[model samples]
Target: MGTSPDRSFFPGSHWLYFSVYLLAFLVGLPLNLLALVIFVGKLRRRPIAVDVLLLNLTVSDLLLLLFLPFRMVEAASGMRWPLPFILCPISGFLFFTTIYLTSLFLTTVSIERFLSVAYPLWYKTRPRLGQAGLVSVVCWLLASAHCSVVYVMEFSGNSSYSQRTIETCYQEFREDQLAVLLPVRLEMAVVLFVVPLLITSYCYSRLVWILGRGASHRHRKRVAGLVGATLLNFLVCFGPFHMSHVMGYILGESPVWRSLVLLLSTLNSCVDPLVYYFSSSGFQADFHELLRRLRGVTAPSQQEGSMELKVQKEGEGQGQDCTVQTV
Candidate 1:
């Protein structure tokens, strides 16, 4: 392995990660919270597999956003650990676990959607929601367990009081052995990337096939939109991040790549809300309705007030001097 001089791990785009975290904090939390409310609100009436997966996805996104504050602190302090050094590994573990869980559940959502649209009758008859919930819980639990390996390895922190008092977080190699990194890195690539990618591709392809073979036009169109949106998000939001990791794994990791990796990793939270918007028609309609209500509520009450004022003026102008008031 090759090594490079130690410098600011994230130099130019420190601002970018911080900004993305701010955005993730703003958009992701609220959207996922709303989704959770809506899904749980109607669970008694409609037990849907897709909704279950969506709930999982939303919760995962929420958890991922929860880590942003610590991230922002780290970035704002110029990549130094001002807090307890023990917290570093825990934070790192949570970060990777959340990422893995998100990918796993997104793939599950796509597969569930595919099955619901492509095999409606079978999907209805089968124990879909129950099965899906079990699977989702397993995925999250498994991801947590897998990522806990870092904690098990007991990685050392790079703390220094020189110049800037920097304390960098990194996994310590056992016995200075490359094999130690190999297993965890491979596990991450496989669980987080390979499996999810295969499932997504397969599900979307099957959806396309079903649509091509004369599925309902409305359903086909909706599914096509979903597939397009999901694929777009998978490519734009996640593809670069994982691809960069693959490159580093295959080529090599230098200090220069660290900034880029962090930048890509931080972006998934921002882009995922867009994916959620596009994938779920119910959510889109509800979100639009919410916007309309908000606009109506905040429209200065100007239109209604003006109408009331006009009516009152006209009433006063009458001979009886009657007044009409809005109740």
Candidate 2:
């Protein structure tokens, strides 16, 4: 096979690549880990249905963050993969896997929330935690299975030249490779992003209509921010990566553009914790306390006092206010 029109990712502005990935690691790691720890406590205290999905989202982001340093090194190495050949595809596989997992989990969260609010009567009648766990497990399994294609395709001589002496993780794809890759990715974008995006949009749109009417301005702002942030994440971060695949398939891969878009996608990991903090009690409590300690605030339980946080009662259907909109 001959080389495609695009030889490789155009190497320029290495500093920008290093900075974006570094920023993701610096902010995403501690916050996601803290969310996990706090959620563990919350799960033990009283498990909320959405907590399972949110926990999985945090885990997925954390997994993605783990790969950023290796990616940063590759960027610094003039966009050449300096790591082991095996590790390249593995990291790439994990990267794509976790991102789609985040999408599916977010979709599930929206659906669960819609059910809880739309039909609270039927929702409270059953055990929700078990159902949520089942959904979480299924999403992970499905996303992982779907993402196996990355490794399979890699081994197929599309991504790396395993047969040759050179072992690159992500190399320029030829025309034939792009022919196979583009359709697969377009399909994935539909399943992983497009469909789920529509589902989440419908769910959140309806929820906003229902929940926004009687809610306070503060509560409305939190819910609105959650919706806005999630949409912004998909559109700004993940959207271009997939769209680039479509455009690249049509116009040939611009490795530089794709690489830059991919970096932006990782920023979602850092942004998700902030979304979780404003939308969940456990995340808020942990983050608020961390900020207090950082600021040298000595008052105990001061977060609750200042925030005037409320909890969901046994019979309440609206959830826990802004924090109640955990989706």
Candidate 3:
């Protein structure tokens, strides 16, 4: 039997990976958390179909960000897995699952928008919230089933090294491992990434075309921004990572630059909030309100002055003078 191939690393790659992972964790964690809070609030007030989809998307991004520290530590340890081997497959599963989950949710969101625009009467008659929930469930099941391959590949019992002796989490594949993994990677590129991309492209194209005919300029502009951000998330953030899968399968081994491309995938968590901002006006309003409150907290005097001015305006309208009374 052929031995496992040695994985090559670019010089200083670990530090670079560690830096990007840390930045993503720090930035994405708060952004997705805020999005989660906002979506939950919006859902409580009104359970809109698009809000439900965005909520699922927010949760998926949070899962990916929460599990990100494993990769961060692995990178910080010079691309070594110092933790228990059991965690390798678990974290790998969550990481890849959430990546494809993002794609699926984005595609579903586009379809929802397209249907609402293209067939409003039909969309109103449907149980949209229930459908969104069902779609979200299917997305989770499908992604989880596909990503379960991580466990099989990791614990295939044919590793050249013992679990304790393994230096990396998911690197250095043997011939048998490659045989199973490469084909699945190719399949994933098609099913999880490519098909979703094509579907998203079609839905958004039709959405834009339909909106152009009668939607107001501001409304159309927002939709345009939504289309641009969603496509950018897919093509810029996810394109290279999935493309690496295709290239790896063709090359019969993982590409040396696959790790670099994955950095872009990590960035999707941060970019998703932009998609949410464009997808729903409620999200934008809540986000701006949060920012406004934050600013008020930061500048107490300005807040007080604004409050006093409001009182003065009300008092003046009532033909009475208002004074600032300090406690």
Candidate 4:
């Protein structure tokens, strides 16, 4: 059998990975946090079933963002397990699990949106909120279980750390381990990623065809934005990771692209909020309200300033009237 991929450092690959992950964390965290607050506020106002799933999606993205510092530390230390071995797998587990959960929710949101527009009657009969919540719970469990494999896959047959400070976590595995990991990783990329990509593409395509005929220009624009953002998230974030995994499996060499692709995968947190904002009317309204609140704060200051100016002008006129009377 062919040997496993070369696990050696690719010159500046570590530095590049560290820098990109830091950038992704900086960019993704605040956006996902904003989305999370918006989604939570939305849930309080009214119980739109779709918002539940969108809320879950936002939370998933946030979860992924939470673990980025660990990865950055690993990269900064030249792929060494700088932290405890237990923590290494925990970070790896959360990273993949949450990202995959995001994919699942994105797919679900697309189908939900398409159904509401495409088939209103059938959609009404469906339990939107209940079903969304159930599916989300199920996905969370399955994703957690799937990611549990990270620890097993990483810790087996190799010392968790090297004689030097550097060691692999999820990045590299032994040649003997390749046989088992190859099939599993390939299947996951196909099932978790490729399947969702195809489903969202089809759902959005049909939505365009159906909505195109009757939807107003504004409505169509909204649909297109929603569809485009969803596809772009997968294309830009998950697509590279999916491709790299399969190619690495076949080539038996972990390429430099592996680190880059993984970093890209974390970007879903940064982009998924855009999807939430554009796709849902409630989210947009919430965003608008948040903007209004910010503007409202300044509004009072302006109002107070005007009132102060009017009072000063009236006092000045009274003082002049008194001077004129005295003269």
TM-score of each: 0.78, 0.81, 0.87, 0.84
Clashing pairs in 4: 5-253
Clashes in candidate 2: how many?
1
Tens digits of per-residue lDDT, candidate 1, 190-309, equal 768778888999988987887788777766776777677566556666666666556646653422454555555556665566656666667677667766877888786888899999
Candidate 1 at 314: error in angstroms? Answer: 14
At residue 286, give the lDDT of candidate 2: 70
The list of candidate 3 runs beyond 4 A from truth reads 1-10, 125-127, 158-165, 300-327
User: Candidate 3, residues 58-98: lDDT per residue as tens digits?
Assistant: 99999988889999888878788888878888899999999
User: Quick one: best lDDT, which candidate?
Assistant: 3
Q: How far is candidate 2 from the true structure (C-alpha RMSD, Å)?
A: 14.3
Cand. 4 Cα-lDDT: 0.79
Better candidate by lDDT, 3 or 4: 3
Off by over 4 Å in 4: 1-10, 125-127, 159-166, 295-327
For candidate 3, the lDDT comes to 0.86
Which of candidates 3 and 4 is the stronger one according to TM-score?
3
Best of the two (2, 3) by TM-score: 3
- Ranked by lDDT from best down, the candidates are 3, 4, 2, 1
- What does each candidate score in C-alpha RMSD? 6.0, 14.3, 7.3, 5.2
What's the CA error at residue 92 for candidate 4, in Å? 0.4
lDDT tens digits, residue span 239-314, model 4: 9888877987888755556766777787777778789877767678878788788899999999999999999999
Error of 2 at 82 (Å): 1.1
Candidate 1 whole-model C-alpha lDDT, 0 to 1:
0.67
Deviation (Å) of 104 in candidate 4: 0.9
